[model samples]
Target: MDPGTNVLDLSQLRRSCSSCALSELCLPAGIGNDDLERLDTAVRDKRTLDRGGMLYRDGDPFEALYVVRSGSLKTFVLDDSGDVQILGFHLPGEIIGFDALASNQHVSQAEALERSSICELPYARLQQVTSEVPALHRQLMRVISREVIEEHRHLVMMGRQQAQEQLAIFLKSLADRYQRLQRDSTALTLSMSRYDIANYLGLVVETVSRLFSRLEEMGVLEVNRKSVRICRPDLLAELCRSSGVPASKRRDAG
Candidate 1:
């Protein structure tokens, strides 16, 4: 996962990945063979980001739309006080840098949560391909729509939820995302640290630690270091939705 030397040749990777699990997610499904070939040719390079490495920083000149090939990335922004707030986590098969399509400048910073690989598709080339391929245009529209929905969900999570509810919902959402990617859903490993989770959830680190202890006591989760095992998914969801349970009682339930 050396960022410098692990760069992949675009053409070879695309040819080897024709039947990859991410094919439908990355390329427009049902595209003509010729168009797929064109796309394969348009892609320029693949780059790796080592753990804790910055992929791009805010205000950086955007060059290409990046597609996550493996591992994970987190996008975040720093407030005036220099506090970082995580905006979203990008998993394998997800697209990063799509927001650059409109602004032409990176609005947020993206960093590797783990050793990660990303395929860089030059923006100019992508625009050219999309202009000729109607299906690709439609697919890009779909991707934008999904981002809108995801942003809305995050907004709600941040604006309305309590500390415990936020932690529950966050873990559940991560599990669901992993499940969608066909990864182990029950055992969740956090790439981000406690401080990152706290910032993302809009809580203090001490509160996050307390919430983890509370959940473990309630029999809903088992946490060790950064790894969590969901023991009672249904009960956890119920707790997230219920306001009747006393905080102490809820802690005991788990």
Candidate 2:
């Protein structure tokens, strides 16, 4: 795919909803054969992005919604100083590019943090098909709402400056997403870079590493490079909750 067109070739697109593993993540249930076929047609392309490759850059014209079928992506915006401020890291079964739905232009760049495949749903065609398939429209709306809620959760989580609170919540969020995908939540690999994680959490890379060591010392988790094993999720959650409170407030309440 050329950077100019930013389009995937048609023949490479996966054209089946019935057998797709991620169908339940983004597709409506009880869909008839006709509606399923319509969905297959609506998502006319599947794009591939190599690690460090961008799905779309900021200011690009938004043409479609991208659903991650495999691997991970990071969405980031450039500050006035041109520093990257990571907005979010996306996992399998998640959708990106919705932030541009109103403006018809990308507000952030979505890049693959690993080799990834994404199903591209053409927004124009999707609108037409969803009008005929009310369930599909409802599913899209539900997905949008869920994104909003998740973003809100992240906003609150990041408001805390303590490494314990920030990293514990971040780990828990990843575990929850893995559980949703029926993958092992206890043991997992974080494909995103430490730098990206630091940027997203408003911390330095060294701080991120230090927090991981602290978590290991607490026996809450074990970290091996990008690999992580949650040894005590309950304890981790407790730390996330308590560490976020101001020290003076905690003392007064105590």
Candidate 3:
């Protein structure tokens, strides 16, 4: 009954899944309150990561899954030439570490794009709780499905689209994600570097820079360094569609 122990417990309770702001967008979505409390117990650790910190490296053991409570992260792998090939950027409320599930080891590295807070759920405990909570299991599948869809979208963009359409699809996808978070969809800050962006989009750095300038001139976007404001979202959407990329299907978490 120590007073300091009681205070620490209260602090942790405030960060529990039931009290988290991203509950609806995260694993707690569509679960009963009782189930949320159970899931919260499974999330054993909440940690802070500084910018450029590596959460996991290629071929590392995957002991737990991480949920981004704040800030952003990028996942990438090294090419045969030892060059970094960017995979994807992860925003707040998204999950990472699924890549390890298939082989029980991570094949890519995840690094923090900024100082961030993350919640960790150990795999064994998560499996135990999900088996007892059908709703939680269903929600987990939905999150994983979204990740698969995004990968397919990226592959299509890289293989078929021109540079302009590729950039358009990337921006439009970010705007959609922002909108889902109930944030301003038209404005976005690029958390990853231009070189990383170029790598992810399969374009050179110069081409990425020139496209930003070209989009600005066309009034489709207003770019100031890493900050971008989609001045004409309609035009941006049109560009995405013009390349024959299928329209994005908005999946509901609930």
Candidate lDDT (C-alpha), each: 0.82, 0.85, 0.87
lDDT string, candidate 1, 190-218, tens digits: 98889888888888999999989988987
For candidate 2, write residues 1-254 as lDDT tens digits.
76869776545344576668887787877889889878887886577889999999989998999899999999989989999988888998898999798899999999898999998888999899999999999998998998998888878878985777888888888899999998999897999888888888888999998888977886888888889999988777777678754344467889
lDDT for predicted candidate 2 compared with the true structure: 0.85
| RMSD in Å for all candidates | 6.2, 7.1, 6.3
Arranged by lDDT, best first: 3, 2, 1
Clashing pairs in 3: none
- Candidate 1, residue 26: CA error in Å? 2.4
Question: Which model is ahead, 2 or 3, in terms of TM-score?
Answer: 3
lDDT of 3 by residue, 1-254 (tens): 77676455776686799778888898644678788878888997678899999999999998999999899999999978999988899998899999999999999999999998899989999999999998888888999999999999989989855898999999999999999888999999998888988999999999999989988987889998889999988889987877632233222222
Which structure is stronger by lDDT: 1 or 3?
Answer: 3
| Candidate of highest lDDT | 3
The residue-level lDDT of candidate 1 at 54 comes to 91
Candidate 3 residue spans exceeding 4 A from truth:
1-8, 28-30, 243-254
